[model samples]
Target: MTTRIDTRFAELAHKGRAALVTFLMAGDPDPATSLDIVKAMPAAGADVIELGMPFTDPMADGPAIQAAGLRALGAGMTLKKTLDLVRAFRAGDDTTPIVLMGYFNPIYVYGVDRFLVDAKAAGVDGLIVVDLPPEEDAELCLPALAAGVDFVRLATPTTDDKRLPAVLKNTAGFVYYVSITGITGTATPDFGRVAAAVARIKRHTRLPVAVGFGVRTAEHAAAVAQGADGVVVGSALIDVLKATLGADGQASAGTVPAVARLVGELAAGVRSARRAAE
Candidate 1:
């Protein structure tokens, strides 16, 4: 069976190109604009789009993402609406991968089987449940994989090598390597430790590893992407969105274009890292 994410990502890996994964709230000010942001990202060099399913209590997120979540919720963004956005994005482009990033409460609230069916129908290729540990994989992991969605796992720097195998088992899409053990949108990270963490994860799995958490600039992205299969930039991007969109989370003047430009710049930074390494 051909997996949606694995196949799409394999094309990039074979060509030895770095993947840029962007994270944004489902409905910032409204669904239409958020969908527009999603649509704009692919052309700006995003290999995979991580559509953040806003939760009231986003413990893993920082100020920017939390506020984005509240705004999405206030705008009447629901689980159903998020899937609708994915369906809408799929309407225009069927190739660029879309991964739903959120907590499992909404998934369980919507019913795992039902949610999987809806997600696939909407063209979503994967999921990133922040609290779903490998030990509790059966709850949604099994159904997620069976439905053709990759249940992507997050391996933090603190994850012990003894437990890396369990975290990686049956994991597809890509392994999200959290550069730091804190919330998203922090600050620049020490790539030395990030590099070591990537090596440790690679020791156990062949899946592509994209590191995130506190990645905020092209320089930071280049630093980590030098040894990573991909670089996941969230907080920085969300920060840009917040700065441009403001508390209302609407795209500030030139905010949408600015965000797109930054994504493209960071992706180019990854390429620069590749060239320097060569």
Candidate 2:
């Protein structure tokens, strides 16, 4: 099945540029404002949108993303509301792929069968369940693929060649390669190593490889885009959102534009990457 994710990557390949994949927590600050940010992403040049399903214990997430989840949960966000956010976004925009990102507990509690049905109905194109490894495909990965939703897999620097095959085995949409070792938003990635890592992964799978983690600026996106099929920005965006918040930690007037402005810059970087490489 040619999902929105596959089609988007194909379109980018035709354009000869890498994709700008943006990740944001659902219901961050509040549900309504969070939806507005997501709705604004595509226009700001985001080719793929990863909407975070706020779980209490996001082991892999950095402080910024963790806090974003807490803010959403504190504001009474739930798995159902996260799905509703996707449904609402779909009402206006159908082309941009929405990938539900985060851990597995929330989905497990929500019931995988029902969540998959609702997610597809909500126009969600894919999922990035970080905790479910290839070894546990039957638990969710296989089921997600069977339901026609692209199951994007994450590969880190530690994912050796021996493990690469399993990681890419059932991976759909695109392969998200974590450029850094730690959590999101910490440390700058070594671009040379990143490029080599991307090339290494490509040797194993035909899937588009997207580099993420520590990509906070336009320059970083450009450098990574040189060898990657997509560049993902999350913590930096969350930092923008956090900086724009008012004293009460609510979305201020600058929140949306601040995030969009950075995205625009990052998009420009991504768009100009091929030229830079040449």
Top model number, lDDT: 2
Q: Candidate 1 clashing pairs?
A: 244-252
Q: What is the lDDT for 247 in model 1?
A: 61
Off by over 4 Å in 1: 246-249, 275-278
For all the candidates, what are their Cα RMSDs to the real structure? 1.9, 1.5
Q: What is the lDDT of every predicted structure here? A: 0.84, 0.93
What's the C-alpha lDDT at position 270 in model 2? 96
Clashes of 2: 0
Instruction: State the displacement of the C-alpha of residue 157, model 1, in Å, after optimal TM-score superposition.
Output: 1.5
Tell me the lDDT of candidate 2. 0.93
The TM-score between candidate 2 and the true structure equals 0.98
Off by over 4 Å in 2: 275-278
Please give each candidate's TM-score.
Answer: 0.95, 0.98
lDDT of 2 by residue, 169-244 (tens): 9999999999989988878999999999999999998899999999999999999998999999999999999999
